[model samples]
Every structure is written in C-alpha cells, then in structure tokens.
Target: MTKIKICGIKTLNDALAAIDAGTDYLGFNFYSKGVRFIEKEVCAEITSVLKREHPKIKLVGVFVNSSVDEVKNILDTCSLDLAQLHGDETPEIFAQLVPHAFKAFRGVPTDITGYEHKDGPAFLVDAAVKGMYGGSGVTADWSAAAELAKKYPLLLAGGLTPENVADAVRQSQPLGRGRCLRS
Candidate 1:
C-alpha cells in the first residue's frame, strides 16, 4: 500500500485527528517562515505525547536549508523519525546527514533532474513556490513524476487530497514499481 503523509500538522488535536484517520506520517514544520511553525518546546511536547500515546505514527521534521548542527539540535529535542530538506541543500549535505537520521529531499517540477545521492534518504516531490517551502496546495506534473518513479522512491506531495489520492496512486504506479503520494 502507498504510504500517506499528512503535512502541516499544527496542534495536538489535529495530530491526533490525522493519526486517527490512518495517516502514516505526521509532519511538523520547523521553518520559521511557515504559518504552521511550531515552537521547539511545543514540538517537544507533541513529540513526547506522540511517543507515549501513538508510537506508531512517524514524526517528520520539515526544515529548510538549516545547518547540520541546527537539524541535529531539533532532532535531539524531538522524536523525529525523519528529516525533510526543503531548501537548496546539496546531495553532499544529505549524504553527511543521512547517517544521523532518516532524510528526505523535497523537489519541484524543474528540480527532478534524476540526480539523487546514493546515501540520501527518500524523495518528496512537492510543489515549489518562488519564495516558500511546501504547503503550496498546488499540483505538480504527474507525468514527470511518473517518469521519475522508475528510479527513485518518489513521494508525491503537491495538491494531494482525499479525493484525488487514489487517482494519483493509480496514475503514478509504474507496473511493478510503487510511488508514494502525500498531502
């Protein structure tokens, strides 16, 4: 089955609701620019709660081009199952960080150059805004994503909703290969 990751989780109530709805991953935005940004203390609280109450739900820390030390600091404080790089981070950065934690790279339509780091973690293909990270609520070219799926474990994350997830999965699936679609 394709994994479902619900992004922009802000409150404990919302997190629980998403978990109850069977979401495989819960994303917490650490980027200060995002409206969904949660304080470190709040993140710690949420992470602790999730660990004790809903251990199965994976916690993902959404970050921009933050330093390795900064990322490590956040991960050390929270129970993050993965770190999503949504900025201009290089493959080398990902390689160096992958050993410390699970890594995911966010890409836009033009960014899908079929170039991926050997040691990089998963790829999250999201809609790219001019001056913003994800949560754009826009749709990416599914055809391009379909083509990229053959090589990488592509996770579709742009403009996905309950209504369109099934179709996205069906259209993006490449025969025996599987791609992930996230909202």
Candidate 2:
C-alpha cells in the first residue's frame, strides 16, 4: 500500500489533523530559507505532543543543504523519526545517516548509481525549479519519475493535490506521497 506524508506541518493542530486523516508521516521543515521553516523549539514542542499522543505516526525533518551534524542535532532535539535532505547533500551524508535520513532530488537524477542501496534510503522526486529547493507548486515529471520508480522506492512529491493525487499515484506508483497542507 502507498503511504502518505503531510509535509510543512507548522502547528500541533494541523499535525494532529493530518494524523487523524491517516497520514503515515509528518514532515517539519527545518530549512530556514524555505517558506514553511519552523523553529526548532516550536517543532520540538509539537513533536513532543505528537509523540505522546500519536507515536505510530513518523515525524520527518526536512533540511536543505544543512550539515550532517545540524540535521542530526535537529532530528534528535525535535524527536523526529527521519530526515529528508532536500538539497545537494552528498551520498556520504546519507551514508552517515542511513536508515534515518533520505535524499530528495529535483526532476530525477540521471545517475542514481551511488544513491541506491539494498533497503537503504528512499529517494523523493520533486519538480525541478531553478534556484529553489522544493515547494515550487509545479507538477513533477511523472513519466520520468515513473521510470525511476521501477527500480527504487521513490516518494512522489511536488504539485500533489486532491484532484490529481490518484493520477500521480497511478503514474508513479511510489512507496509514498508527500504534500504540504498548510491549513
């Protein structure tokens, strides 16, 4: 079955609502430059409550080009279960945080040789927007993502909505799907 991840959760109420709606994962953005950036303390408080009340729902910390240490620190402090590196982080970084962190590539990478490993980290395929990390609100290349999904456990992101999610799922067939629901 395809899993669901609600990204950019800034409030406890929103997080809880997403959980109630059957989201398997909640992504809290740590990218200070991004629009949905949430403070560590605030995310921590939200995460603490969520962990207590909804332990089964996984919490993901979204980072953009942050150092390995920074990601690790934030994940530990906020009680996050996973990390989504939405930048140009090296494979070595993923290696260090294996099983805890994964990579997000924009528009699908031509060469995914080093990134793929046996039951290792899953890759998130998002729309490629110049000078942007993510949250572009542009539809991703479904055809390309579908080709990649044939090999790896990809998480389809970018431009997913209630109207088009079914089509996206049908086209990509990813392990999961991520969308930012700010309401």
Candidate 3:
C-alpha cells in the first residue's frame, strides 16, 4: 500500500486528526520562514500527545537551509523521528544526517545526475517556486515526477488534495504522498 503523510502540522488537534485518519507520517515544518512554520514548543506539545496517544504515527521535522547542528538540535528537542532537508545542502551534508534524514527537491531536476542518495534518505519532490520552501499551493510536475518515481522512491508533495490525490498517484506513482494540514 502507498504511504500517506500529512505535513505542516501546527496544533495538537490537527496532529490528532491526521493520526486518527490513519496517516502514516506527520510532518512538522520547522522552517522559520515557511507559511506553515510551527514553533519548537508547539511541535513538542503535539508530538508529546501523539507519542502517548498514537505511538504508531511517525514524526518528520522539515528544515530548509539549516546547518547540521540546527537540524540535529531541533530533531532531538522535538523528538522527531526523521528530518526532511529541503535546502541547498550538498550530498555530503545529507550524509551527516543519514539514516535519519530525507531530501525534498524543488520539482524535477534538469539533469538526472546523482538524484539518488546512497545508503539513506528517500526523496520528496515538490513544486519549484522561486523564494519559496514549500506549501505554495502550486502543483508539481507530475509527468516528470512520474518518470522519476520509477527511478526513485519519492514522496510527491505540492498541490496535492483529496480531489486530486488519486490522479497524482496514478500519474507520478510515487512511493507515497505528502500533505499539509490546514488547521
């Protein structure tokens, strides 16, 4: 079965709703400038409840352009199970966060070189927006994503909703889908 992840969780209510809805993963946007940005304390509160109430839900912390220490600190403080790196970090930096890190790309790459990371970290392909990290409400390139999906186990984000999720899945054939909770 395809995995479903709900991203941009900001409150205990939203977190619980997603978990109750049978989501496999919950993403907390820690990017300071993101539209769905959640404070460290709030994330902790939500995670605390989820861990106690719904231990099966996995928590993923989203970061953009942050250092290794910054990501590590937040991951530990928030008790996150995985880190989604969505910035300009090199593969080497990704290596440092290996086994606990995944990369979110800005749409499909012009060149397919090195798209796959060795030994760790799956891929998340989102819409390519200038000066934006994620949650832009813009649709991603599904045709291109479809091709890449065959090559990599990716999470397709950007402009996915209940209405279009099936189509997105049909076109892209990603390993799973990633969503953001509005509330």
Candidate 4:
C-alpha cells in the first residue's frame, strides 16, 4: 500500500482527522512563514497528545533553512519521527543529520543540472514555488522526477489531494517502485 502523509496540519482536531483518514505520516510546519505554523509550545502539546493517543501516526517537522541547533531544539522538545528540510540547505547539512532526518528538496524544472547530493536519508521532491517555501499545491513533472528517483529514495509532494493522489502514484510508480505517496 502507498503510504499517505497529510501536510500543513494545524489543530489537534485536524491532526486527528488526518489520522482517522488513515494517513501514515502527519506533518507539522515549524517554519514561521507557513500558514499552518504552530507555536513551539503548541507543537509540544500536539506531539504529546498524538504520542499518547495515536502512536501509530508518524510525526514530521517541516523546516526551511533552519540551523541545526534550532532543528535539534525542536526535535528535543517534540516527538518528531523525522525532520524535513525544505530549503537551500547544503549537502553537508543533510550529511550532518543523516540516518536520522528526512531531507526534502523542492523540485523545479530549470535544468536541475547540479542538484546531486550524497544519498543519506529519504528525500522528497516537491513542486517548486516562486516565492514560497512549500505548500504551493502544485505538482512536479513526474517524468523529470523519474530520472532522479532512479538513484534516490524519493517521495512526491505538492498540490496533491486524495482525488489525484492515486493517479500521481500510478504515474510515479516507476520512480517510487511501490513506495507510499506523501503530500
């Protein structure tokens, strides 16, 4: 079965609703710019509640160009199962957090020539937005992503809803190889 991750979650009720919908992963935006940004204290409370009430749901922290220390601080405070990097963080940054983090790269159609990075943790290829960090609700070129997915463990994101996710999964099956979809 394809794993499903619902991102941009805000309230605990929404989180619960996603979980109830059989979502495998639940994302919490920590970036201040995101509309679903949650306070650290609120994140802690939600994490606590989720851990106690719904341990099956994996929790992910979405960040953008944040320092390692800051990421660690959030991880220490909340029960994050993974850290998602959604900025221009260097490979060195990904290396430093390897095996314990989920490094996400926003995908764009401009060449993507020098976008190679050493394979560390699971990576995501999300649709690129002009002036936004993420949550653009746009889809990337599945054909372009196919080439990259050949060498890396990839998860697709951006503009995905329950309606189109199945088709997206089918189109990305070659890249994903039956892996779950995350949007």
Q: Cα RMSD for candidate 4? A: 4.1
lDDT tens digits by residue: candidate 2, 35-79 = 899999999999999999999898999999899899999999999
Name the Cα RMSD for model 1: 4.2
Task: Find the candidate with the highest TM-score and give its number.
Answer: 2
Question: Which stretches of model 1 miss by more than 4 angstroms?
Answer: 99-121, 174-183
- Lowest summed lDDT across 10 adjacent residues in model 3 is found at 112-121
Q: Would you give me the overall lDDT of model 4?
A: 0.70
Q: Compared with the true structure, what per-residue lDDT tens digits does model 4 show for residues 91-133?
A: 7776676555766666733433333445432567777778877
Measured over all alpha carbons after superposition, the RMSD of each candidate to the real structure, in angstroms, is 4.2, 1.3, 1.9, 4.1
After superposition, the stretches of candidate 2 with alpha carbons farther than 4 Å from their true spots are 118-121
lDDT values for all models: 0.68, 0.89, 0.85, 0.70
Q: Model 3, stretches more than 4 Å misplaced? A: 110-121
Query: Which whole-number lDDT from 0 to 100 does residue 77 have in model 4?
Result: 95
TM-score of candidate 2 versus the correct structure, residues matched by position:
0.95
